[model samples]
Target: MPAVNSQPRRARSGNRRDEAARVAVLHAADDLLVEHGFGALTVEAIARRAGVAKQTIYRWWPSKVEILLDTLIEDTAKRLPVPTELPTASGIRAYLRDFADFLAADPAGKCLLTLLAEAQHDPGTAASFHERYLEPRRIAEIEMLTRATEAGEVSPVLGPEATMDALLGPIVYCALTGVAVPRDLVDTLAENILRPRA
Candidate 1:
């Protein structure tokens, strides 16, 4: 007969405490980045803000950049959900809406912009970001675009990469240049990307 519980039981209380501390540290890091920007973020500050020891943070993440990147990943995963089954223009619209909402509502948006800037000027940071965070999501998005193109949801001529660039460029541009994206830009982007070319 098979055992009712196949896995070994662990110390639930210890694990919960660890998770709570970890979450506090991540949230504190995110809040600091948003409130003070990247330059002002530090492990000591995160510890104080999170009400944890500095060593606790360093135990999990080696550096401040790693903590910030991890926070960004966690925030994106929570906020900007991409549909995994089928990629439709409508699904893209939904994803875009969620992304826009995150930018408007969450501090992670500031962290994202800061990482993008670091990627531009700092190679080590860029390497870590691409290897750990950006590239995997990028590949997934491109695959999503491929499915969208195949389903006649977007223009095949531009293919996945170009279409993705077009759709993403405006959001980044508006963010970086201080121009506001229209309230309906989510719908506008979905329509423009999916509409037939002349």
Candidate 2:
């Protein structure tokens, strides 16, 4: 008889602990990434911050950029309360205000701004940033735009993609440049694109 492989037994035990460890590592990596810009960050630094072996971080994330990107997304999700219900213009404005406050309050925002700048220099990084970070937020904004459209709050003229871009562009542009993105701007952005009822 062929010998039975013990891999399954090892996998079951390894996976749970591995998942926990990865989460811990991410928590640590996020803090460090915020404290030090990506240019100054290293896998060893993340491991040291997280109190895990560097090998563990390597096992989970291939590169520092990948790790920082993932950490930023998770951190942003936790900090920002993205409304799941259909969004009103006021609701959208509120979220944007809260998001802007979150950025202004934390060093993470600067780190993210820097990462975005770096992405311009590195096409591969830009691709990953778009796919992993920007796409999901765009989808969520599109859903909100659709809701506004349905409620007759937004004009039915602009297509969804254009609507989303118009709504999001100013906030993102201001944030990237480290300027204040006012809540009023979100309203102005939506109104310009959506032309909501007077």
Say which candidate scores most in lDDT: 1
Clashing pairs in 1: none
Model 1: per-residue Cα lDDT over 53-96, one tens digit each = 88777777888888889898988888775677777777787777
Scored by Cα lDDT, where does model 1 land?
0.79
- For model 2, residues 31-149, the per-residue Cα lDDT tens digits are 77667666778888888877889887777778888877877787778777567787676676676677667666665565566667879999988998889987887787778778877
Residue 31's lDDT in candidate 1: 88
Compare the candidates by TM-score and give the number of the best one.
1
